[model samples]
Target chain A: MSEAVLSIRNLTVEIPTRGGILRPVDQINYDINRGEILGIVGESGAGKSMAGNAVIGLLNRPAKITGGEIWLNGTRIDQLEGEDMRRLRGKHIGMVFQDPLTSLNPLLRIGDQLTETMLEHLDISRDKARKRAAAALDEVGIPAAAQRLDSYPHEFSGGMRQRVVIALALCAEPSLIIADEPTTALDVSVQAQIIALLKRLCRDRGTAVMLITHDMGVIAETADRVAVMYAGRLAELGNVRDVVTHPEHPYTDGLMGSTPLASKGLKRLRQISGSMPRLTAMPEGCAFHPRCEFAQDICRAEPRPKLNGGRSACHFPIQQPAEETA
Target chain B: MAMIQVKNLTRIFDVSKPWLNRVIERLPKAMLTAVSDVSFDVEERTVYSLVGESGSGKSTIGKMAVGLLKPTDGSVLINDIDLSRETDGGKLDKARSDIQMIFQDPYASLNPRWRVREIINEPVSARGGNVVGLAEKLLEQVGLSSLDADKFPHEFSGGQRQRICIARALASEPKLIVCDEPTSALDVSVQAQVLNLMSDLQENLGLTYLFISHDLTVVQHISDKIGVLYLGRLVEEATPDELFENPKHPYSQMLLAAAPKMDGFGREIDPPQGEIPDPINPPTGCAFHPRCPIATAKCSAERPEMRVVRGARVACHLAE
Candidate 1:
């Protein structure tokens, strides 16, 4: 992809705990090109959200980004001051979270929230911002956008509220959007709608997206490229089709096989044995060596393996795709 | 034979404010009909799944099935004994033993203070059954080690806690279990493990399950028969094969279409337009008509009864 909109070079986030220093997001690197959606998928506590938070500078107390650079449009943004980072959030890097109810202010009207963000980001007139908010709402497929803008967040249904949230995110015309589980809270139908809306609006406006989710199906459906994270590290990164259909990492393959697709029939799903290790108890060398089917002695003794072309962290990337193996 | 029979099950929740607040606001008494006239049967040793989004009354129906929540209007029969109408204490106790409930949140379901042994033995101990070695046996049955019986709920992971809950449910030796989104909270891989364990247990022990989940794929995998709910109403019911192959109801079709498929990577999804109508004052006729793609004038005027079409029970006028 040409002209990457968002680039992460060896980003790491560490939290100091009673047990020890917990590295939730270990040195991982990826890029989201202009108008591309990069899916970051992992199980709970795999640091997908932590990575997104580090990018948006929303990490919790004591969980600080320790190493590497976050470049937005060629500008290193990891060390931006508080006010500059806050300004950069709405103007350059908009964020959408899983729950719309929490993201939106229930006391304020949808129009007011949209206009407030727009006015903050862009030096535009109030009338123009209101018109743009209505247009944004319309673009996200909220029916009777102009009138419904006056309604409170509670008045609109869950799906409509998500659409309004998406509109709020898009109203400022951010170059990058970090949508962390944006559709996880919605129904399957509503999830599809929101995903499609996100894809369309982002594509039209050339907005790069960093979609963080645990659902492989969502990543398969919406993502341009996929990054599989395991125990705070990137397990695999490749084209969505290649990574999903032809997974190079054993962990990615396990995820693909575990999903109950209609084509796979009613057979027992391929489950990854044991759960992800807690951050404090993460294994030496490769964090996933304990659960990996292809783990060797080298995996346990060596530092995290870096794959050729930085595509995967597995020491021995599978030559054959998982589908053929299965 | 149907191990569990739900007949016209309805649960109405009074969602209005306090009497004084209501009087001051000039608002009349309000009730939200969470589950309305829902009926289905779980055959002996078969899995019957109820699939729906939130507020579709799926969880309410599940709760009613296991006697956790009493229905406002209808009856849930376990082994042909009416759950709501059972008056005798002895009969109610016997019926309760036959039906066990597995809740959604494993973290909150099990008492944190209680050890796994006590948690699993509660059902057996209540009925004066042999509690000795019961927890150990149940733990082993659910793929956990016997040593785990000594540990507290907080000592285990989310998936392990869910397994403990399953073991506790099984300790009662229930004929039917109402599982309310059993694997939704677990990771995808862990979800598969739990589902596989449940399927294996069902096959080996002839256990019947009234599985409830919003995930279409999980439901499709586990269910022999499936019911699609929309706003407390059953819009479609059919075998998983029949339902997935050809969904008759527009709501069911929309759900199937919107369900994310791994095979369709990079494929653009065309989800149905509109949102779920307000359940308190739902659409004029069909609750799903507002979001349904093939909704007609008749759809908004009169509700369609479940009719047998193409080997499926569908509540849609256009399903021929």
Candidate 2:
């Protein structure tokens, strides 16, 4: 079996509100191997980002990891506290967020940020760290890295700033990367560049990446495996080819059908009937039963199904048509 | 006759530093030609879409078409009446009333302090038109309940707020509506619902739409005609079928190729070269010359005019 770089088992996150206790992420499980890209896809309130925040130990107050285990490289990290988790962040895990400006300090020079990260995590001289910072910029394909080192974050364009963010994330040589909507703010051309850079870096350095995005196309082109989330639970998880080409879960099928494809001719998009259920007002049985087309009396009466050695968490997984399977 | 005619519409913004700063720094005035000599026409009850990346001036053109921003040069004629140059007050008011706009970012577009009823009826009330039961009728027409009229914008979700905006746009019963990225902010499933509603409204009311968006897939699905823009210039225009199947311009081909595909799993593509050029100091001849894969001395020395080629209007010297 391949080495698992990150293993998350039955992870659950809860937030206490005035209305009630909200479980944003509920009983999610997945394993990301070394040098693999695991894409988490869902809608706005689907708790995809909450799961990632829990792994990094960055959950805001009032929101807590109620249950689960997060194992990184064989070490149980869910119980790690502040100082220990801070140390683990730069040295063992790197992050790239949706907005580049928020990640980078606007006042500091690009080189200073990179060198400071390296000096804090790696045992190296300041001079060496500075030199490595320039090389890091070069690796991400920024032109004139050495001269541009003194420039502030505002000096670079949106795409170039994102490249710098990628360099900073990888400067400490972490074993895993958590990129949440990294290309959502970028144009198509620039988005392609960033995706290619992330893919190449993962392959070359054997880094495990947990890429969280709502774009199916990005996941289709980049991920080796995909996990579909709906209403704070794992709807389906499998190989990217199987999940995207033929989704077993009814919700996943509806999502794929709704996304308008450029390759397809003009036609009305197949819309899911209603919006995702809010966390506070979640239904009694399966969270997706109300919106699911395959829901039965059993689905509404029984608790939500667990993956339990199968790919999808549902009462009835869509089977492959005989003709297509043949 | 076309419902909307935009002729040589141009808008230039002064992006230079303030007077004292420019004098101290010995800098010249910087002008950004946001929409440079762009022309297009939308027939009655048809959907015409302008598509490009950020800073490509698609939004600027949409603003010009709606008379929200006066053009530095050229004009926009709606129903044979020039909104910018028409001196008669009665004629200009009537033309303005015939046009309405739907903006992107549903969160920002709707007024939060007012009830949905007042927000929808403001268009009619401001013009001294009777707004009795107008809000409820339009709300029901847009798939929202009549009870929603009493709630504030904060009480609704993103898709619901956009539906309210559509209701407000239709309150005036305008002949043409300009939609700028109406569904870009919504989730995919909700986006499908909103697009379908827009299509139904157009068919029922015989309304024309000038849609501006950065998403190619959504544009291809919704537009009757698509205009591809690059650096404030229209590079190609065609039906979605022709544009997607047989793209003549290199830039159009690159855009279609770069858009992530559903069945493109494990496929490798050579990333397109270079980013969009600075609009202020654009290229000398063709704005796309610097990034064109096939470029020669002629491409850099002379600008290409839009010409009919292979059943599409293409602005490339080597397109033939």
Candidate 3:
């Protein structure tokens, strides 16, 4: 994905636990091309979200990015100071969170919240910012944008409120957008609309999107490529169609098999047994081995061989070795 | 004969400015119709699913089925007994016992402070009927270990908590279970396990299901027949295979299109054209006319009666 908008290399995140530093996101490397939609899919707590948080510098307290280079466009954001990072956040890298209610200021007027971001990041005046905010609302398909601007988050319905969140994120025309489970909270129909809107806007503005979600269907529909994570590591990375239809990692395969599909009717799902182990003490060799039906002794002995230079795409990286042979 | 039947089910909430506020502000009163004129039937021991997007009244129907919510209009009959407080004690008890409800949030629905034993024991205890070692048996029935009866709800993960909820529901030994988005709160991996458990329990126990959810795909996996609801109305009803393979209603078509396809890759089927109509003052005739791609002028003027079209019951002017 060269001509890449964001380049993440050797990205590793750790949490301070009583026992020792626990790696929630092991070293991983990947890049998102301009205007492209990169899907990250895995079961909940698979570290898919951790990767997104790490990229946006939004990792929670007790968590630290131990090593990595996050090059947004040409600038390295990983090491940028507080003010510089803050300035770049809304202006250059927008984010759409899973829960709009939590992300949005409940007490503040929608207009004020939108304007606040522009005011902080842009040199525009209050009037222009307000107008821009209204237009952004309209662009995200919110109706009567001007009148609704003064309303609080609670005043809008779930879907409408989510649209407002998207509008706020889009107002800055950020080069990169990180949407972490953005549609998971909304209804199926509303989710379809939001995903469609995100894709269309990304295409129109040539803005790259990093979609972090567990739903493979969303990724198959909207993503150009997908990077599947498992137990704090990248298990597979390839084209959406290739990865989804012919998943290299056993975890990806299991996920695809497990999900219920619209066309399929009255059939038993192939459930992946056992819960994912806690991040504090992940398995020694391959984190997914505990639940991997195809796991062997080697999978639990040593860490998997790194292939994306630092991306951990299974112990035996699938496509790379095949590509090497070819 | 069907085991449970709902007729013209409607639920209207006083979601308006209060009477005093309305009088002070000179504002007209408004009511929110959570569900309006919905109707359906569940075959004996079969899984009947109500599927729709959020705010489409799927859960409302589920609640009404189990007598958790009283219908604003029409009636719900379980075993030919009306679900009303006025009904005879024996009849009411039978109806209530015949249908048990499982809530959406396992975490919230379950009592965190109570032991799994007490949680399961509440319904059984209330019935004044005894099942020997019922707590242990229920945990085992739901694929949970007998030892699980001692732990608190928080100790288990989201999936296990839901299993406990299922166990609690089954503890009443109900003929039907109204599962309202039972697995929506669970992770995808965990969801599969719960769905499988429900299906297995249904076969082994001969339990009927009134599964309500916004997820069509998940419904497709478990439902024998599916009902499509829009703005609190039963817009379409058909066998799962037939409905999914050849949906006849405009609302069903739009819903199917809007659902994210699981097939490898393709352009999204263009979704329904507009937003969900306001439920209270729903469009003059058909609530979905505003969004129907194939809407006719007649659709806006006259409410179409729900008639069978090519084997599926559909409520649309265009449907034959």
Q: For candidate 1, lDDT tens digit of each residue in B151-187?
A: 9999999899999999999998988888999999999
TM-score of 1: 0.96
Which regions of candidate 2 fall more than 4 Å away from where they truly are? A323-326
Fnat, 2 decimals, each candidate:
0.82, 0.70, 0.65
The stretch of ten residues in a row with the least summed lDDT in candidate 1 chain A is A261-270
B147-257 in candidate 3: lDDT tens per residue? 988899999988989999999999888899989999988878889899989989999999999998888888888998999988877889999888888999978877887
When 1 and 3 are scored with DockQ, the better candidate is 1
Off by over 4 Å in 1: A308-310, A321-326
Tens digits of lDDT, candidate 1, A218-282? 98899999999998888999889889877878888888888887236846878889889988787
- For every prediction, compared with the true complex, DockQ reads 0.76, 0.76, 0.61
Clashing residue pairs, candidate 3? none
lDDT of 1 at B192: 88
Clashes of 2: 0
lDDT minimum window of 10 residues, candidate 2 chain B:
B265-274
Every candidate's CA RMSD: 2.2, 1.2, 2.7
- State in Å the error of residue A88, model 1: 1.2
Screening candidate 2 with a backbone cut-off below 3 angstroms (N, C-alpha, C), the clashing residue pairs are none
lDDT of 1 at B290: 77
